[model samples]
Target chain A: MFLKLNEIGDKIAIAASGGKDSTVLAHIMKLLNERYLNRKIFFHWLLQRYDYGLDLFLLSIDEGISGYRDDSLETVKRNQLEYQLPLKILSYKDLYDWSMDDIVKEIGRKNNCTFCGVFRRQALDRGAVMLGVDQIVTGHNADDIAETVLMNILRGDIARLQRCTFIKTKSEETIPRSKPFKYTYEKEIVMYAYFKKLDYFSTECIYSPNAYRGHARVFLKDLEAIRPSTILDIIHSGEAFETSAESNPTNVTVPGVCNRCGYMSSRDLCKACLLLEGLNRGLPKLGIGNTEKLRKKHLDEKEKSIGEYSSSKRTPGNPFIQNFNDLKLGSDLKKPL
Target chain B: MKINLEFSGGLELLFDGLKQTSVVVEDSSLKNLFKKIESELITQNKELFLKDEKLRPGILVLINESDWELEGQYDYQLKDEDTIVLISTLHGG
Candidate 1:
């Protein structure tokens, strides 16, 4: 019901993960597209009917986790065939020159989810830009939003806590991303998929065994079991929270483009650029946690290794060439002098 | 008593990647049927399917294509050749 399809503009893409929620979202949108275009007279009385010939496509991001992403991509392909919607698959390797597998190898399993989570958010935006879609919709259900609200509160991340409950998020620079299933229940999504015999991939990431969100999810699900309304209750509570300016003094700053990749960033380098630099320099921890402190450490390490340019030189052994320059990603990092 | 059980949404992994199985139970109650399936059918990750002698919170139970919540959840009576589907909603979105 939160889809607000008419406001989503003509060209739209669903950020499908091939999970049950996204699969259900894709299927629903496809069905709606058919009805909205083919039977306009039936919905003529509705004030918010879709435009003529509504365009819908599925956009998927391949994080390149071995056993996880490859299998899921197959499901997305099948969905493409079933829904008769065009599909565009973009890989982390193509976008960032680092797969989740590569990130895990360099940084170990501890904080790789950070890399993936950050990379995927931007990957979806970039993919949307490439597709020239007006808006991107994700299958983030009420359960997901509620869990995220709990997580933000638990982590005391007031910034995100303030922003997590919105049904649609928009900024001037990027494509608007919205949640069509904002009020939908996770159980309902799975049931729809099951009853329809929709194909979906449903495996946990092998590297995300210890993700912090998993704990929040289990806790939320437990609460949901006890009271089915807990999911929406949490969301309502999050929206009702009037975080005072006394608690969170808003940081007012103009957003600028990353010097390295030209992505929108408040700082000179975006998070992805910083993370990529860490991976390339063999200092995988450089981009994670305490940015200023890590930048100091990275510069100190670069100073210590100045005599050896081998670290800066792209590894001949690693087959995926750093395509940062090719993609207008990392054209600005000067060689260690 | 006999029942058909189906697992999906990654619960199949706990059943050695098997999606469906038929098991014979000594009783006609859902609880007894789960106990039988737990002992006979489940090959790995029993905890994912059950916790503290109950179905895990994230898993949804359907009795003959209806929501188990509406059908008495884990206490529903099982008839001969009934189909019960257990789907795990815990996977990534």
Candidate 2:
């Protein structure tokens, strides 16, 4: 299934969460690279060879959620030595100035996962940049993909549903991310990790008690119990639908650099930047659903001072200078205008 | 029957964060073994690992390094010093 590894570049970061899927993936990739790529073989075998002269790193994100991410990161650090791979750690505190704990305290637990998820996605990219890796590989397996497909279908998110089944995904601006375990089963992964006695961290996030994705996962697990093939079937169905990433008229969000952090984004500000602004300014809701109005508000305020607002332009918002009460949402903050 | 049981991939979280345990049982069936483990080991969230008198859907059971499905799932007889492994495949990545 991973004969495609031959195409991967010289250096890549495995987005390991110290989970079963990634632990197995890391071991398998290293095994294949050593056994297959180092030898001179026949033409057919060469095509199947996985050697890309790859430099491997374990990239882990610390959401600073205390017991959860910190515990998991310890396992990642152990694997750094166990797997003979270097490790990189990026924290939400450094990236966005808010840990999941702090975000939860402000936003309330209801929507903090959204902040963590969005920030973690870009944090991986930024961590890759710091590590000097051009490609990022995650341990997303068949079950994960299927659950995402179901969730996207439930939410009527066609663009994301169509893209969820892809083995490799990259926007025009960000580093490429791939999932080699796309065809592997969660059962097989755990089994392999167990029989091999690989170390991993598995406690659920303390604050993730009521995530909507949890429902999708339970539904998918039930379906797998009845028929194991259902997971792959959902992925195949997802792949059957076609949604153009570029020309989707309804969701005209195209890739651009964030006006705040200069990271890849589809809007003036990336989700991380917007969420950071919300956290620092005490308006965590500003980063959640329907951010369009808040984004326009930022631009309009900028326009009043400069007399002209620029689209396709980057605005440098002051995250520290604006001050209100420590937890105040809107007033007395010395607004940008 | 004396058995060696191991739980992992967060399944251990149900067993008070224990990854491995050894127990002696008077009854030898896998079902009784599960009940014994539940009564003796499971500290909390019993339902996360068991449902409707069966192991939960996402937990994989292995006996002596082979899938329990190959060796008669819950009916497999436990032997002295037999190794049983239960791994949960349910957590997010």
Candidate 3:
């Protein structure tokens, strides 16, 4: 933990989601703060409203589990009351209004989970920045990291494999994000949670359709079953490799305030603005670029025209003569001298 | 230089998607190497690469242990024995 803390300074906020990993992370941060040198350590619990289609019954059920409909708000309130840490909870109701299908159609994402992940990241970053924290810590344990590594390999995403390793410090125009449990395994975190009896929600997100990651997790579990140290081996193997420092260039910082909603982004409009544009235009699939379908349609039209012309005229000369007559008879054509 | 590269989690799946195990390039710039790799991927699997006139988002590139987003984009220069890791952001909880 100390080694992990060395990477992040004293002023930090733990993103608590009321889940096992986050709860354990918050606890560990608190314990470390108490045992270590005297400094006013700040911990903020950040949570998002997990919208499940706004059914009153469902919302009531959610409220029953976490005193409030929003998990982040509840976690933050608890933190303030129990741990006495400066906490803030933010909520956005847009997710409930927009279905996973709606988001996917607008963003070209396959599932709701992808949309949620991106939205949550932006929300957390903005929230943390507003709170004025030096570093933002997440409960991304070893298992999650390992699972991510496996998934990235499967998807052939080279950039993600390189970037996912250590705690992510902010790039230019980005907030500094860190993961203290990057080295800590999921099992250890879970074990610690269970042993310490930390209060956390055991239920998975209702809309997590991560079949690919699920397969990776299962594959890793199978390998770990054969060799308990296999997880560590994978982690060490990831640590051993390095990416070419030159290959990754920072994104060109774009200058513009978002027209739809004011948010800092390099593009003239942020992703959210783009999504809204697509939605407003009723062209949810506009940006998805189903180029294959378009290509196929174009080929079909060309083939159909060719077939029509060839069938109508046995000699290619006849088609040319007909075209010449049509052009001559056209309104723009003048009489021949 | 023969560099042994390893990918974790979703990144390992890239090997399945790749036609070659290691990329051999005369140039040493990370940008050039990545361009070569992207070209190879496009040539082999045009359907995947040419989706939206660019490589799909959510995929990340890493040099050594740092994220390309953190280090630099494709412009990062490659040294002898440098390993590049490609991963996808597919993690969900």
> Top model by lDDT, which number?
1
Docking class of 2: medium
Tens digit of lDDT per residue, candidate 2, span A49-70?
Answer: 4445577788888899888888
- Cα lDDT tens digits for candidate 3, A93-211: 32223444445445554644444554466556555544556567788888788878888778866657757776666465555777878878765565465447565554334445467
Model 1 chain A poorest ten-residue lDDT run: A328-337
Tens digit of lDDT per residue, candidate 1, span A117-142? Answer: 88888777777766668889899998
Clashes of 1: 0
Predictions' DockQ, in order: 0.79, 0.66, 0.02
Best by TM-score: 1
Superposition error at A243 for model 3 (Å): 4.0
Candidate 2 — which residues are off by over 4 angstroms?
Answer: A1-9, A41-50, A244-252, A297-299, A302-337
Q: How does residue A106 of candidate 2 score in lDDT?
A: 82
Q: Choose the strongest candidate by DockQ.
A: 1
Taking chain B only, the TM-score of every model is: 0.91, 0.94, 0.61
Give the poorly placed runs of model 1, Cα more than 4 Å off. Answer: A1-9, A41-43, A47-53, A244-246, A249-251, A297-337
TM-score of 1: 0.89
